[model samples]
Target: MQEFELINRYFKGRGISRRDVNLGIGDDCALVTVPQNSQLAVTTDTMVCGVHFFEDMSPRALGHRAIAVNLSDLAAMGAEPAWVSVALTLPHADVQWLEEFTAGMHEIAEYFNVQIIGGDTTQGPLTVTVCAKGTVPEGKAITRSGAKTGDWIYVTGPLGDAGLAVEARKQHLDIDPEWLKKLTHKLEYPTPRVAAGQVLRGYASAAIDISDGLLADLEHILEMSQVGATIQADKIPTTEAFRQSIEGEAKWPYILAYGDDYELLYTVPENHKAMLDNKLNQYGIDAVCIGQIRGGEGKIDVFDGEHKLDISAMGFEHFAEDEAC
Candidate 1:
């Protein structure tokens, strides 16, 4: 199919219509207007075929993930999603695959009320890049540098399920069929916490999405805030499904080191803790308290009961051998 024809066939006008989008797909450039008293929150994420996901994975899920990951970035910064642009590279124009992919993208885009403004398509091995834009009231966007020494650390939703799916697939571990189904659901259809991010606004001191495992992603906040932290190992909510699915210490590596959880890890000052507790439940999000920020210089300590656990920094790294959490 022709390049423009392919886009028109599968992607054009797929996202929800938005007033902020002065111009959308098929244009030389997308023209958008940021609302008064709001700042644009923009983020881009690229997913390669083999590196980011198995080459044989479904295009439908790929479409969702391509958009979801970037949305996760906006969520971390307390932004409400508004517009998205997609740059998709393909080996060839497989009509069926493209249809399913766009369907997946449309599902999330409509759910979030975001518009697909513009993008490009090209021939390549296979890669999907999405640039997501959102809005946050001026001076209200949560950032990594805003964390303070007295802030309490929290995470939205469970962790390690997506990571478990990766390990089960890569190592050929015999995970229970029912459990594998659950784990893979997390891996493939992660729900970006866009609403939670918006609600966090003035409540959170700092926030980050857990795309690269808890420790690795939390490090971004630590580095930026110039503070240390102490995590209670038992307090890391690994979900009841995870406990019922995996056995013994086997789940620890996935919970701590494996990436792709896409949950939000954030900090709230002690004074605002009550406000967060009161408001977060209204969003139907459970924020688990796992740690506290401290005055040290980026040191992270994890404790299991009375003993301090020894853990290495083993989160996902591009172009490096995989390591355990």
Candidate 2:
């Protein structure tokens, strides 16, 4: 299919229509308005065919993930998502694949009330890049550099399910079929914590989404904030499926180092703990506290009860000499 025809058929005039978007797809430059008293939050993410996902991944899931990951970044900044521009590259367009892909993208966009703006489509190896935009009240956007000593660290939900899913697929390990199905679903359709993030704007001292594993992403916050942390290893939440499928020492890498959970990891000051808890509870968000920030230079220590555990691996990094996954 031709480029314009492909976009017109599958992407144009679809998804939520937002009043803030003055002009959308089909225009040379899409126009959008930032709300008064708010700052625009923007993020971009790209996923390549073999590097980011398996060749056999579902087109629908790919579409969902492409937009979801970018929105996750906005969520980390306590921003309300407003719009997205998708740049899709393909070796060739297949009608069925485009239908499924657009369906998935539109479904999530509509859920977040975000409009699809203009982007380019080109011929190449299969890839998708999404640039998401959002808004947060001026001076209210949470950042990684805001962490302080004596702040409490928290996560939106369980970790390592997605990592386990990837490991299971790569190693061909024996796992219960039902459990594997649930793990795979976590890997593909990750929920960006949009509402919880908005609630955390004033309450969280520092914030980040767990796209690059808990330790790796938390290190970003520590480095930016010029602090350190000590996490209770046992307190790091994990699914019953992960606990059952993986045993003993094998669990640490997936739980601490592997990525793609997409849950938010944030820190809150002691004085704001009660208010933060009440706000999250009102939103039906069951956030778990796992650690505390300390006065040090960006070091993270893990402890399983009284015993200090030695951890060498941090998280996923592209172009490293030894890339895990």
Candidate 3:
């Protein structure tokens, strides 16, 4: 059967929704409407084999990632997930692959309470693209540029675990069994700080999801918000497990430049810091104040209290063919 036909069969078999979806599968484009008093938040992310994941990567992981990255973007906007659409490209329609992939995607959708409302399937290179839709409370979408000088910078979780996980897999290090599983999970599956973003709606002056490394991503907020920042190299939260794995070695190289972390980096004003801290513990996530935004233009400083650290090696630029080769 054709890939779309198979998908059509799957969608028909499930029978999830009918109202609010005026145009679904078989149309040139799918259309849906949101009720009054809600604003739509949409984000799309694409992953290709070899580019995003290594060869022979598990379908379930790909499926989970396909949605997670997009959802992370929505979380940065403080959006509550409502519906998601997928665009999958595959060389062939393998039933086992589709089953596993959808299962993984469905797991996250259920967890976030978003339904797979519409999408398309086609034959091509093995790529997964997800466009997720979420809704924020009217008049309250978090942005990347609301930060002010003296506002406290915060990160919701540890950094660089995903990068380390990728390195571990590439090297096939004989890691301790316990640590191996955790790091592998980190690389393959990063939890989006959905709950944290939701709670930060009122307290956060600016917010961004850390798909990219912390410094690099925060630099986005700085650039957009027209400000500079000073980060204390010691203040970033590193998991005891992650720190132990590195044995007190230098961390900024990876933690500041690595992508795929999928945590939240945000700014909360000093006045709201204690309140936010109280809420952080109440919400059950570690919120680390890493730095303060300052008034200036496009400058980021890394320091150990009094001494400055050169940060020439920061941010992930896309690899060119020459670099890849």
Best-performing candidate as measured by lDDT: 2
Model 1 global lDDT (CA atoms, 0 to 1): 0.85
Off by over 4 Å in 1: 1-4, 316-325
lDDT of 3 by residue, 1-325 (tens): 3556686554433434536666665567767778679798989998877777875768888888888898899989989877778888788888887788888887877787766766778877788788888888887889998999999999898887777677666666555767767776877777888888888989999999887777778889999999989898778877665665664335666677787879899999999999988998998988898899999966888886678877885554322222210
> Tens digits of per-residue lDDT for model 2 on 1-325?
4554556667776777888889888768999999899999999999987778877789999889888999999999999999998898888777888899889999999988988887888877888899999999999999999999999999999998998887788778899989998999999999999999999988999999998888889999999999999999899888988888889877888888887989999999999999999999999999999999999878998998888877885444322223312
lDDT of each: 0.85, 0.88, 0.79
What is the total number of backbone clashes in candidate 3?
0
In model 1, which residue pairs have backbone atoms overlapping below 3 Å? none
Candidate 1 structure quality by residue, lDDT tens digits, 95-140: 8889899999999998999888888888877888998999989999
The TM-score that candidate 1 achieves is 0.95
Which candidate number maximizes TM-score? 2
Off by over 4 Å in 3: 1-4, 10-31, 172-174, 305-307, 315-325
Checking candidate 2 for backbone clashes, the offending pairs are none
TM-score of each: 0.95, 0.96, 0.90
